[model samples]
Target chain A: MHGECCFESEVLAAVVECRWPERVESELRVHASGCAICADVALLAVALREDREVLKSIAAPPESGRVWWMAQLRARREAEKAASRPITAAQVFGAAATAWFAGACFGASSDWFRSEFVRLASGAESAGIGVFLTSGVGLLLLLAAVSIIILVPAAVWLAVGKD
Target chain B: MFRDATLRDAIAAALAPADSESGSLVESQDVRADFAMDEDSFRSFYDRTARGLWAYLARVTGDRQAADDLLQDAFYRFLRAGTEYESEAHRRNSLYRIATNLARDARRRSVVRPDAVVSGEDIERVAGADSAGSLDLNADVERAMSRLRPNERAMLWLAYAEGEPHVEIADRLGLKVGSLKPLLFRARRKLAGLLRGKDSDHAR
Candidate 1:
């Protein structure tokens, strides 16, 4: 390996640079004519140069309009998908607050309704009919509050997702 | 932080009432206003550069489908950024920079994926399939390229394959202009060695 022909390796560096004058290629060709290794290096350079062209031809990308359109479409789709996932701190906080409010209202109303039912059934009311009417009205108000608390935010969330 | 900004823009774009999907393709008032590049300008830019960029990507990644996906992603990100370029070359360089990063990231990801491993014979067969043996040069080129580092492949491709000047390659790859020449020279020398060593083995 101490006697290795520098042209055998140097020709490759020259070819890779691709700035070699015709004189350089001619000299390399002459040197290659007498040496097998140099010839291989020269061949490699030509093959590489030719390969670039091959890549250019084969890698015909999609049409400009198509590429552009697809990019826009993809961005929009990804954006929409990202928007749908509720992971942001603000979004998480909003959801939590909505859940808590709904849970509190439902719990309080259910507790009151349970107590009212027990009292009404045990005949502990001075005005039994009036008490029943009041309890019925209270239950309706609770149901309305629960519906608003649950439905409004759910509607808002769905609308946000759509947007 | 960059992801956060991208995420924010993406969310904003998503939440806007879409004018129409098809209509949005040619001209999006939202994108145009943000980027300040009208439909014609973008179309013109795309017409001039997309194919070449795609070619660069394909050679770098050695995968046509990956090139396709990256090409789209590159353009989408470029549009999303909305940065004003002083000139077409600057814009082109910026696009290539985005593409280079995307291809690099894709390569990194593929290395981690279990199924990304392909046999040497399979790669050769696929590379050889492009054209008869005349284009078979790419087969060897791709084979040799697989042996090099990703950045080496990129610098070599941009310098030799794409004919980009040293300064431009530097900017695109985030290297200083002074360092680009030596780096590119080293990459070329290394690739030449890889090509010789690998192909010689195949010949035997």
Candidate 2:
């Protein structure tokens, strides 16, 4: 739309630069009619414009509504899927933390029991039987501790995952 | 339904090509403000733009199936981006940018596969004529398009097929406006030569 040599610039931009036009402007047509250089530009632009229409005509895509519906459904599903991942991660972390807390508590309680048993056994006149009992009890506590540490969190995590 | 129609009108106006010299930045801002956070709004927007976008994807990738998958991915990423744009053109450009990047990444992940065999019924449908000649020509055009590098194909399609201005095409393709001209020139010349060679082969 610029006057003088800017017409050539515009024509060049339209013809060689972008090689497309949504619509040919009358001003450009007028200028091209007057200028030989722009005349060739105009011809090329017109041919390209025709080619654009031909390409468009050849392209018959699937229905817009159908594509849109599929996109909507996909977006919803993806959002839902993305929302679930963080929750799953948090659940796993929560399960592990809970297991560690439970183990610590079980270990502390076992220590208390062992200390009490030792205290009582040390103060006993017949400490051999008491020491044997303490050893037996300590073994049972260790087994209980191992079982709780291994089984409880596995059960909790799986149950949470199912939900 | 009335409210939905009103929303659709608003979005359409927002996305309509800029009319004023200053561009539709202000109008688009107003439209973005009204962008409904519901599926219905997004669906309406999709209805307005999907076919052209899908056709562009199909043209660029030369695989209808990849187009289908990429179309969904493009829209999904657009919705997730949640960007406020200066104009409808800007939003559309952003969508194309996303689509271009996705297409490029997908192409990098896997080599271009051979074209699927076109069933007679499908070819007939595409040709809309009984002439097998037109079907062959259409297939040839697609094959020729596939031979171009992905970015070259995109630039050519955006320039000649989509009628996008250099500035918009540059924006979508992440190229400088000044650089688009020479690139487009080369692409157009190559395409013209391919078409000419195809015509000559048919003459023989």
Error of 2 at A28 (Å): 13
Q: Which runs in model 1 stand beyond 4 Å of their true positions? A: A1-45, A70-98, A103-114, A117-163, B1-27, B84-88, B108-131, B178-186, B198-204
Clash numbers, per candidate: 0, 0
Best by DockQ: 1
Candidate 1 C-alpha error for residue A42, in Å: 7.0
Model 1's TM-score against the true structure: 0.62
Q: How well does chain A score by TM in each candidate?
A: 0.46, 0.42
Each model's C-alpha lDDT? 0.65, 0.61
* Residue B24 alpha-carbon offset, candidate 2, angstroms: 39
Tens digits of per-residue lDDT, candidate 1, A107-162, equal: 87887757766766664456555565466665576567678767767856764555
Model 2 regions lying over 4 Å from their true place:
A1-89, A102-163, B1-48, B83-88, B111-119, B127-134, B200-204
The alpha-carbon lDDT assigned to residue B115 of candidate 1 equals 22
